[model samples]
Target: MSRKVDLVADLGEGFGPWRMGDDAQLLDILTSANIACGFHAGDPQIMDETVRACVERGVGIGAHPSFPDLQGFGRRDMGLTADEVRTDVLYQFGALHAIAAFHGVPVTHIAPHGRLGNLVAVREDYADVVASAARRLDPELIVLAQDGKLADAARAAGLRVGIVGIADRAYEDDGTLVPRSEPGAVIHDGEEIRRRTVRMVVDGVIESRNGTLIPVACDTVLVHGDTTGAVVLAQQIRVGLEEAGVEIAPLTDWLE
Candidate 1:
């Protein structure tokens, strides 16, 4: 059977003169674009430009919301409560929604960025906050939890859940992502990513850091657009997946 996957490019990086990522090149390689809302990275102009890029390329667009941390780039953990998460997500999503509206594009999904994303992946309350906030904004919007229990919780909350299957980082038995600071945390080898992603898409399973096989259902695959070799990696992965007969599609298309 041929495999199908949704490849997303993370867009909307930096604020003002401080730029990050090869978003333009990455957009050429990805099917969906996760644009950052103001809090974490991206100003209004950056957000508007990212939205237009997605529209021009026929790529799906989503809000990449994060904690309000420009200096830390939203990588530092803030231990925010559910209420805080709700408020933060609403604020950022609203910003991106307005920009998307201006571009005549509908925001397709919500992917939590950086530390906030990690929090929602494992923390039940935070996941609820994300789902609740999204539902409050628009009940039709999809909430991308992309990991373990949160995926189930998002679904249970009556929100459309997009599971992000392959992890570039490791995960604990409990399913919380292995902190990037930990040893053997992030997987950078191109071959490894290719192999792991194959198993995830074709077999509906993924190997953990301990070499244990775990069941995971994924609707979308995230390719970081802010990385140094992002464009190359995204291109390689797309080519590799296609060569393996895996069909590349956008998350929104898959959901539809």
Candidate 2:
């Protein structure tokens, strides 16, 4: 059977007067969006605007929650407790949920942002807390993550998990991403990224940094919009997948 996957990007990552990536361009190439909530990089205006744009484009909306680390772009470990993590996640999810509701669409999924995203893949406690938060808010919400603790916990909570494949990041043999501090952790070549995305979505496997093939359960692919030439790269990835006969659809449509 031909593979089906969602093309997603992180959006609404702008603060007050400052913006990060060209969200408008990314939105045009995406089937779903992991929009930032207030705690990470979005404000009320950005969140509303982003969600509204998604609604207009028929894109699935997802809440991208993170630790309250606005200055660090949610990439720094704040060492928050379990309850803190849960409440923070719920708080962010609630804010985006309201915005999405106003835009006449539901927040279809939850993807932890930055540091929290990395931790949930490895830390059982954090993963369980995030899963609990998702279950509490909306059991039907798909949890976007790698094949790890969060994926396990979400399934355990009786929620559908959408495995997110990131083609630009280096992965370990065990399916964990290599830490950013490591050399050559992030892949920058556009052609390589496009190739990787096609392989990941069609073959259900990714080549680890050490040249080992690792099995990955990919239901969606995240195309980072913050990189240089990101829009072009995203466009190439979408084209590559389509040419490879992979169906690009929203996770909400096929996650379960």
- lDDT for model 2: 0.90
Q: Mark the regions of model 2 whose C-alpha exceeds 4 Å error after superposition.
A: none
Candidate 2 lDDT, 1-256, residue by residue in tens: 6778899998899999999889888888899999999887999999998988888889999999998999988989999998899999988888888877777788899999998999999899999999998998887999999888999999999999999999789999888888888998899999999998899988888999999998887888898767778889889999999999988898777766
Which residue pairs of candidate 2 clash? none
Give per-residue lDDT, candidate 2, residue 30: 90
* Steric overlap count per candidate: 0, 0
* All candidates: TM-score: 0.93, 0.97
Off by over 4 Å in 1: none
TM-score of 1: 0.93
Highest lDDT: give the candidate number. 2
